[model samples]
Target: MLEARNLYSYYGKSVVLQDLNFDLEPGSMLAVLGRNGVGKTTLLRTIMGLTDRTKGDLFFSGEPLGDRRTDERAMMGIGYVPQGREVVPRFTVAENLKMGTFARKDGKRAIPDKVFDLFPILKEFSERRGGDLSGGQQQQLAIGRALAMNPKMLLLDEPTEGIQPNIVQEIEEVIQTLNVEHGLTIVLVEQNIDFARRACDRFLVMDKGQVVVSGRGEDLNDEIANKHLTF
Candidate 1:
């Protein structure tokens, strides 16, 4: 559903990604793996047009995203959940999810029942302030906000990072359900190798801002992890 050809992304003058080429087919979940500062998050940012500049071409569903703004891209059906889970702190849970529906081209403001179904806690905490929630709850809110747009492709940066251990498993299951059951294409940047392999159909390993190793999920073995991913 998305293709990158010889992609290079920049933040101000520093070129963070170089000559990257990858394709994510429809309904497939692809994991982007790497150690810290290898441009994994930058890849997702570039896709969302959040980088300072990007060279080469990015095609979403056969259309080139040439100089498209971030909001425009969202309208074209790409949802982003950044590493920080930037939910509005002042907004109530219902208000935060409602903010997501503004991206809908149909002008519908109603939060989808699927979103509430996927995240029952969001419904329970509908009246609570976002800032009052725990870390894991905030992460779920972030994902819910993205889902409120009802995107065709979801870009998640480190979805399982920094949350409680008990809630991490629940988040993992949700990501999988979105891809496997709900048929949402996903590009996930994650540190957990075992979960990546189990949940994703394919994997790409990055080093120094470029893809160094890539294969089907079964191909991501111990040797590849030790060679490129060990910190």
Candidate 2:
């Protein structure tokens, strides 16, 4: 569903992603694993056109995404939940979710029922201010907000970061459901190796801004983790 070739990304004048390449098939999940500052987040930002400059080819569902604005890419069905779960702090839960629908090509604004099903807490806390929720609740709101756009591909950056263990499991199950049951293409930037192995169909290990090791999920064993991922 998505492809990149020799993808180089930059923030200002400094290049952050170096000659990366990968392909993701429809209904498949890809785990992007790396230590801090190895360009994992930049990969997702480049895909969303959030970076200042980029070189090389990016295609979504067969069409080249050349110089498309960030909003244009969103209209093309790419949902991004960046690190830190950047939900609108002052907005009510319902309002924050509604913001995601602004990118819908069909111009429909209603939040999808599937979003509520995936995160029932969002429905229960619909009237609460986003800033008032706990960390786990905010994380669910962030994912639900992304789902509101009805994206074909979802780019999640550390969706389980900074949450309690139980909520992390909840988020993991949601990610699995999104890929296995709902068939949403996902590129997950994750730190938890166990969850990555359990949820992803394929894996890519990034180092020094490049994809160094990539293979089927079962191939991401202890050796690869110790060599590329251990801190």
TM-score of each: 0.98, 0.99
Tens-digit lDDT track of model 2 for 91-173: 99999999999989999999999999999999999999999999999999999999999999999999999998899889999
Candidate 1: Cα lDDT at 88: 93
For candidate 2, give the lDDT of residue 168: 89
**What lDDT tens digits, residue by residue, belong to model 1 across residues 136-164?**
99999999999999999999999889999
Instruction: Tell me the whole-model lDDT of each prediction, alpha carbons only.
Output: 0.94, 0.94
Off by over 4 Å in 2: none
